[model samples]
Target: MANNPCIIIADDHPLFRSALCGTLQRELNEPQLIEAADFNSLQTAVEAHKTANLILLDLHMPGAEGFSALVFLTAHYAHIPVMVVSAMEEPDIIRRAMDHGACGFLPKSASIEDMTAALTAALAGNLWLPAGIDDTPAANEAELNIAESLARLTPQQFRVAAMVNQGLLNKQIAYELNVTEATIKAHMTEIFRKLGVHSRTQAVLAMAQLAINPNSTLEAFRSQALPLQ
Candidate 1:
């Protein structure tokens, strides 16, 4: 096979964007790649090249409008495939993107093997999913609690939580969410308080529990809590 495939990666964090590029460099042979740091940059990059084989999209870029960007891509470039790459392993977001024409989803915690598999599958016209999902819908009560919990958050806090769930560092989340790192720090404090948890891992776990079961309650989470670190 020729190195004819091209990829575009849209993310606000320069370091992560660069890291993704490196991943591609390691995994792909002579792959053509483009980088964008924001929504406008992504839009510009896409307009500049309509023939890209894949778009490695990050939904929570600063001012990127998340799913709205996915909609735009489907409307304008219906033929192109989009692989949502983010720390957001939230099943709802994953399912919703698939409903809207995304070709695949890659969680940030995805292993290198996972990335390679997803990319290869997407390139071969297959819709890819993480291991263990296995034909079952990712939903549940805990996911519902997360939804309710998020619904109760201020827009700023919600954005922060979303980024955190996506596995971004506070500084990176700050950049993508368009606030200072200090602001993100403050928001984390508030988010922990609101979610009744003290850490990002706990919040993500809570969301995962909720996603698998919408009826998930905080009490249920308490029973299964990891010992305090």
Candidate 2:
């Protein structure tokens, strides 16, 4: 596989991963294939193999609560193309994955031919979706806005926000992130300002809203008492 592209198959199911690997081996020209069963390992693999050409990500894998892993990857590793391969094929899910910067979406049930085609297109810098699936109905303006705001966050601030969502206290987050409590507080303040929130609770709530229903409109989000600030 020397000098060939490196592709990651990030899925928790061992059987599915094996099948996908077999298909890739058959379809591709002996590309370097890396396998990860969870989001943490996926991140580590990506970091170690900076030349990776593509990532086949699963939406519900361990350590990837909802679209958070996708969001984190797109935010931090924007250069590597990601193609989501998930069992969930709902249009809304597909649309959201695309919105979060996935280059393509392949349902787990797709045939080997379709998988090959999708992966080829994504590697060539083209977006791919299943046939008959409308690519319109893009993520609502509110969702887009939120994504843009989140993208503005520094990497450390982004990590802090995720910890906040996990209900970690400021001190706990500080210890885990290996920063002083005051440094954590300063990061939280900036995070709140960037996210348009006044308090930690409001900041957490805002992130929760996006996580829960990223496709919802501003009005719908407000209805849940998640008004900006």
Candidate 3:
């Protein structure tokens, strides 16, 4: 109910974003809205609008690998609250989003009333969960600990680690980030140190711990670990 609260809608879907914008404008008092279609752009928007009141992030965006973007934002932009807005509303994913630092989880299918309530709670600095979901943030677990470590990474280092988790080589990461390979190597060293893992494979495993589908990351890592025939 804060007057003219600035909100960033960080989802890739244009129609849905527009509709959500309309809903907020109608329900709230002159809410200022910003749109970001991808994770990278969300970061840019956050940087440009550091005073933003809230960010409605998509579960999957171009530069977001699982809940990594959530972790990065909560870590780097600790002041602004992030309420994840996504179509994937599985209970576990919603809980994990909160555990990883999301203020709320608003399913894309949420009714206008539900969206308004969730936004109100989040803006008031409270946690919000969808109907039938437990309001509590997830309990302490191995992934939470790993999230703590990943939270320590600088923005650039987080990007490097995310790229590494996707199996990108140092040179490839450097090219994508428009930096030199040696600079990337230095980043890798820091990322490993921060994550408490020395090798890229170990870093990958560490990062995988934060994936939305817990089983899939472990399974994929296991398949990679199997001996070649």
What TM-score do all the candidates reach, one by one? 0.58, 0.81, 0.90
Cα error, candidate 1, residue 147 (Å): 20
Judging by TM-score against the true structure, name the best candidate: 3
Q: lDDT scores for all predictions? A: 0.72, 0.79, 0.84
The TM-score that candidate 1 achieves is 0.58
Rank by lDDT, descending? Answer: 3, 2, 1
Model 3: per-residue Cα lDDT at residue 19: 87
What is the C-alpha lDDT profile of model 3 across 1-229, one tens digit per residue?
A: 7899999988888998898898988999999898999876887888889999999988777666778888899999999999988889888788888888889899988888898899999999998888899856653477888889989998889888877777788899999999999999999889888888878877777777777776797797788673322
Model 2 over residues 56-90: C-alpha lDDT tens digits? 99987674446767777788889999999988898
Q: Is candidate 1 or candidate 2 better by TM-score?
A: 2
Across 104-129, the per-residue lDDT of candidate 1 in tens digits comes to: 88998999998999999988878998
lDDT of 1 at 200: 77
User: Which parts of model 2 have CA positions greater than 4 angstroms off?
Assistant: 1-3, 61-65, 212-229
Model 1, C-alpha of 142: deviation from truth (Å): 22
